[model samples]
Target: MNDSDDDFSRFAWHTAEQRAAQGDSRQVADLAVELTHRIEAAAEQTRDHEHQLAHLVRVLAITPGHDSLTQLLRLFTRSQGPGVGLAPRFVASLLAEHREAADLVGPLSERDPKGRLDELRICLLHELILRGVDVDAFPKTIDWTRVKYGDHPLVWLPRRRSPLETRVVFPSRAINSSAHPGGSVLPKEGRLDPPTPRTQERSALVDTATLDLHQMIVSAPEAGGWGHSEAWVFRADEEVEPDRVPALLPTLPMGCVEGLGATSRFEIARRPADEIWSLLFATASIGIGHDGAHGAFGRLWAWKSLAALSDAPADASAEEVEHHVQQTTWFHFESDAEWFCNEIFADYGIAALSPDRRRIAVLAATATD
Candidate 1:
């Protein structure tokens, strides 16, 4: 390495990261461009290449777009600590944040044949969706199991409206208010008839997805301990209205809010169905809770929960996921009322009516103390 490279290796990038953290967007972008040059020009056969790449990977957080994504992926292998698996998350975030990164996902299995990029693949899909790109429109990458969710793309084009094959019973109002302090649609009796066949089937899928979420595989994050999640299903007596779900949800029984008075009351607001996955993925995403790879549990849970709710097979595709979500009438809720509370922050949930409106699935999670 030359004297200037030595100066950068010893002092420059650290200050770059510090400046980036201190709100220097220009410095971050400039550092990313510089690091890409240094890392790319270094030969893989060079004795110090991996060492140089490993130490400099930390600067990725300073910027995105022109960050040394592909180069770093090929050269870096070490982590700051054992079991950290920090590289994939950084690569994933860099990919998601980079304006030109969307093209990288279509060739998953070959690019990451050993599955090193799994979680990043999932997050990139998410970020692209947020950008309003039609991910299902991407060319079929045949037989790559996990990214497909379990199937090939099916809902790439909007299907003509048809009565759904799956159905659920419409809920009766246990609480009538949609204002501050929402009310439950659960019966005052606080119980339902025996579990329906639909419940058993969806639960089986959920259980299986849950198991995968708990695995300590490369790039896949474990189940999160920072929040509480639960599922409750009820048979509807009438047609369930999706817009009214914020009031009809069984928030009290779901432990989303404390029921202190004679009636269960908490404030709740509905979020767009397309938006919930990102909102859930955002929980505890920075600083100590989600340092690099560790904070990934949130995204895993978000992906798994929605997939399970749709009864999506392990190989289900993004298009099919879109179809199922459209078939199902679901509400994603955000609340700050005293009754709608998490251990340390606001609580949110999904109250979904099975396609036929015969079964209602209510799933909720709240950050804990």
Candidate 2:
């Protein structure tokens, strides 16, 4: 080897050994990138190229730096032959980051064969969700199965059970409130029934909205866990005027807020007022759930019914009110109302409006009278 190449090899080896011994992942990643370059250059002349490359891959796999992981993935794609396998553990680790997994989607898909590509993508998706990516953005048709992460097989997605036969019972005051024009048009018990199946394709706009909502929800401190009962209710009246929505909603100087684990950025889409309202309601109440359940489905129907109620006259009948409430109810049992209020509503200035557009209810578990 030439003097310059020999010097580089020596430096790479020394750095790798030092960083590995110290367990410095960032420094190890840096050294791994340098070694990758050396390995590529010496591919034709060096007999030790495979050993060097293997070491580089191993270091990069364990490194927490996303840039280093990306470089390693790119190198693996370029250098490894078709028959060779990329390390599943390495791929899984890198995919634990939302941005990294998203970046890999196209490249991994293009490089690996169909079945292998699907497997890798599935693994990446699984990790992304676990890391708090929005559930609404997940691919709808996932054939879930366990893949080996190390010695153990890991399940990325579990099959959901059949929808529950349930109803949403509104508070007596809320049912009798002028928010519903028709007197007691709802069931005698003031409950909203479950929604019918929807055949319409979800809009891409809704997808974007859902992603934002997911980020906001997951970033909140108290968002995760089962049986969270906190909720907020807000209302906006037609007399308020559509142009005032921005002023009425919360505003952050840069449209971003920092919470417990991650920073959340939000933007209200410039759509018609009604469309925007519906989109936000649907995305927040139903689409943000980690899994499909009766609660989410019921919330979707409830929002739709609320929209219909907004159009009904104030003197609407009990049956009419019941019909609307039954059309929509809370579906997400795991929803964090405090998180929604603090992170979503408080940050974004969102208020939930009654069907008549006369009242906004901000229900939250943390709310104090």
List per-prediction Cα lDDT, in the order shown. 0.43, 0.35
Cα lDDT tens digits, model 1, 115-178, are: 5444445544544443445555564422322542333122221222112211111111111211
TM-score per model over all chains: 0.47, 0.23
Q: For candidate 2, lDDT tens digit of each residue in 268-295?
A: 3222233323323333322222211112
Cα error, candidate 2, residue 264 (Å): 52
Task: Point out the worst 10-residue segment of candidate 1 by lDDT.
Answer: 165-174
- Candidate 1 residue spans exceeding 4 A from truth: 1-55, 60-71, 77-86, 95-99, 102-225, 237-253, 257-260, 284-288, 291-301, 310-316, 333-345
Predicted structure 2: clash tally = 41
Which candidate leads in lDDT? 1
Error of 2 at 120 (Å): 3.4
